[model samples]
Target: MRAPLRSRPGPGAGHHQVLFFIAECVPFAIALVVLTIELTPAHVVYTGPLLVATPALAAVTMGPKGTLAALGVAVVVSVITATHNDAWGGQQVYTNLVALFLVGAASVVTSRAVQTRRESELNQVRRIAAAAQEVLLRPVPARLGPVRAASMYLAAETGAQIGGDLYDAVQTRYGVRMIVGDVRGKGLPAVRAAAVVLGAFREAVHYEDDLVEVISHCGEALRRDAALAGAGAAGDDAFREAFVTAVVAQIQEDATVELINRGHPPPLVIGEGSARCLTPAVPLPPLGLEEFIGGPPGRLESYPFAPGDRLLLHTDGVIEARDGDNTFFDLARAMEAMRGRTRQAFLEDLRDALLEHTKGSLADDVALIVVDRVDRSDPVRGR
Candidate 1:
């Protein structure tokens, strides 16, 4: 089996640390070299300016705390080196003190400016990501052609606007084509893979004549991107490991729903105070993991989705979610708890149950899509 994709650390935290460390050390190293060469008064004056400027540079790159720490180190180095050189008093000592004080003051100002700019950039990126998430996985309308739907997405990582989990629905000539998927990783690479899959799924759902063809098209798109990246040997395994597990379905006028499962957990069909899994007859390999001579795509499975039938499709994040005791979430048990509940109640109850099961924290991104066929006997809004 291929190794799972590892999430990259955020730039703001890790990058700041590395840059701050380098910035703090550079001037200290320069001072040491000057001391070795027998530091002169002229050298002391020139080096003093650099000692002050070094912490300011650190502030610009790493913000306030880092700048303050660098400044403290600079002061200690200057006082110790000067004392050792027998130049601790007189005009020379005053010059060093003035430089140290100026460096600390400059660092304070620069650090505040850098922190303000960083916060602004972070806010802007979060806004953009929020907009992108809404566009990519739109809220399921209160009602579709013959179904009422609702969905929820919760990213695993805190402050993460989006991740690899995806869902989409659209009214096409065929019917209400919908899908929910989970890419193999987290962070930007997984997000990029999700974008590729979702972009292809949207285009294919409207244009492709068959659901199987639509799934194949999405797989082909990812494969092409992997090849282009020269991910040749390394890329091939990455694509395989970065596979997407998904379930795609279409609802017909008579309430007959057809669906295909690609290595995804089966969706649950809830009706008449009972819940059951809609397992596909022939499950196919996940997208982006096609073997050299892959078997034909799975046959579309069909079932009668009578009025009041609520179908719940979700990523493994739901089942895989764990509690403090390390117990996995039992979705079936939760559904049983909500037996005979109204659509809205069912959703709310399920969300609450899941949150409780995971103790409000999940290790993977969770996406839930619920589709319910409305009762036809109920008053028709318009003939």
Candidate 2:
């Protein structure tokens, strides 16, 4: 059985706390050792390295705050050591204090420099990732055959360009094929899985003659890669869980849509003045979780998609998004607010609602795609 997903404290905050705690305790440990040893002249020789190491240690392990704290502790230790040894009356005390002060200052400066350098490198990485994400999931043109469209992809975590959730649309010989899915994990691994799914989908969308065959081909691709990498078991389980829920659709030339659901959140079809869930019958397993061949593919459900009708596909990140109070956002209410709005307006409202719902801190990445059919007689081909 799959483990239930839960929100946890940020790893970065936890790492900071642990580093601070360790740095704070180091000074006390040194003081205890100094007291245990008799106040001898030889002890002063050992104190020099400790004084230098304290601030340097903090700078390397923690940040500015930690380095400052370490410096303060070192000053206190120097004063106590000097007074105990009757060295305060001599110039040695002044020289030692000056040296310790310089060390602390250097540590502080070094820490800030290191922090700035790391931030710059991270920003560069984020930019590269964002650019790659754009290339992998390029913008879907406003029109796909008879459909007009718009989309939004929001990473739940700050400074993240893409996550596990993914969506793609392409015009194929069969029709305009689209997919929305979520991977089971996060970070680089999830991104890799998403890329695999998308890459296979793109190839199959053009070559495969049927939607089911396309899904099966993508499944085979994932399975082959898993087996070749000796990741068959883990990969199978990961894909099964990640994409355990997905929805695939093909828009026919006759303005009808045929869809397949695999334990995924049903999509919403907005028309006239209301939105309705396009629930599937005889739901199949998610693409990668087809462990065994089943009976013949189920019949595809059809819906009349007239000009101006809009269909929205989204990952669970939207509905499952939680706020500080841990309450889920009202997806239905958001959709209701989007009624009667243009495709662009609808997406804008949805994005605004998601931000408002999570107060700008969502725990899961969101990937949404909208397809709106344009009037057949309208001269505007791509808008």
Question: Which 10-residue window of candidate 1 scores lowest in summed lDDT?
Answer: 1-10
lDDT of 2 by residue, 94-162 (tens): 876788788889989999999999999999997898688787767677777777777777776545667
Candidate 1's residue-wise lDDT over 1-383, tens digit each? 00112223443656776876776677556546545543555444445665666576666566677677777777776776677777666686678678778877877887898789889999999899889887777776656677767777777665776788988878888888888999997666688788888999999998887998898888888877766655455544544457788899888788678888889999988777677888887768888887732667667889878886878888998899888899999988787777666555666677677777776766787777878887645543221
Which runs of model 1 end up more than 4 angstroms from their true locations?
Answer: 1-97, 231-241, 292-295, 339-352, 376-383
- In angstroms, the error of model 1 at 282 is 2.0
- The lDDT per prediction is 0.75, 0.73
Lowest-sum lDDT 10-residue window in model 2: 1-10
Q: Which candidate is the best by lDDT?
A: 1
